[model samples]
Target: MSSDLWSFALNVYARPGVEDACLRLQTAGANVCLLLCGLWLEQRAVTCDEQRVSLLRTLTEPWDAEVVQPLRTLRMQWKTRAVDDAVLKGMREQIKSHELEAERALLSRLEGVAQAWARNAAGSTTWLEELAGAAASPNRDALQVLRVAATGT
Candidate 1:
């Protein structure tokens, strides 16, 4: 999608009423990697069919996409051996780097969508709740939004 369209979609998808859409996308096999893409489409109030949404859901699930696949690929790339301390340390650093890279990519995409919502001064409690639901773990910002939504402050 074009950058403008992508930005627009992110804002719409991050709105309060998009949980159902997110769930639908998750169920459809869309990767959590493409969360920004989904959020963008959602922000635009775009709707996907039941089949498509289901496919996206499958794609994003931990078992199918994010955690397991990366681990599997890593396992294949490295040899599991009883190495000395220095080698083990280097390997550990490499693994950490890989994990960090993956996290950065995922967060970058999600943030693209979330930044739009975060900039808004006014949004419904429902939008906050949806954002909390859609956010990955450690979603401090979404939690804050939820708190604001709850107190109506």
Candidate 2:
């Protein structure tokens, strides 16, 4: 897997069923940004522990909640207007671009956070599962789909 977080995220997300699975997990209150980061870390065989998970969450939660989510919400809200108005459509597309950039920035930050934890021989899905947390419990089927997609198992 690529060491670049953004590239890795794109690769993992493009896998069959991954997008839908991510959406499902997101609906269950999982942060898709963190999930993607966790997947990337897993690919790198990084040791996932409580401290690493906490650090990742600390780095991502505020940005995802304040920046990415708002951009995404606005872009989604414009869907109807975009279909009818060309100007609104253009603006919506711009918002989508911004959203993508925001996610890229988040991924970069996550990569930095995991820099020291990389290249370990030991890796597990435990981090991903822990990151998913209890909020994702009800969405186990969706989470499992994501796990399979991430690990190719």
Q: Rate the local accuracy (lDDT) of all candidates.
A: 0.44, 0.82
CA-RMSD of model 1: 10.7
Stretches of candidate 1 exceeding 4 Å from the true structure = 1-64, 67-84, 124-153
Question: Under the 3 Å rule for N, CA and C atoms, how many clashes does model 1 have?
Answer: 22
State TM-scores per candidate. 0.33, 0.91
| Top TM-score model | 2
Q: What digit string (tens of lDDT, one per residue) describes model 2 on residues 14-58?
A: 889889888888888888888888777777777778998898899
Provide the global lDDT of candidate 2 against the true structure.
0.82
Task: Kindly list the per-residue Cα lDDT of model 1 for residues 1-153, writing each as its tens digit.
Answer: 323533343444455734444454444433433554344434334443444344444443553366546753564455454144567557756776776466445545444433443323342323322332445344434334323322321
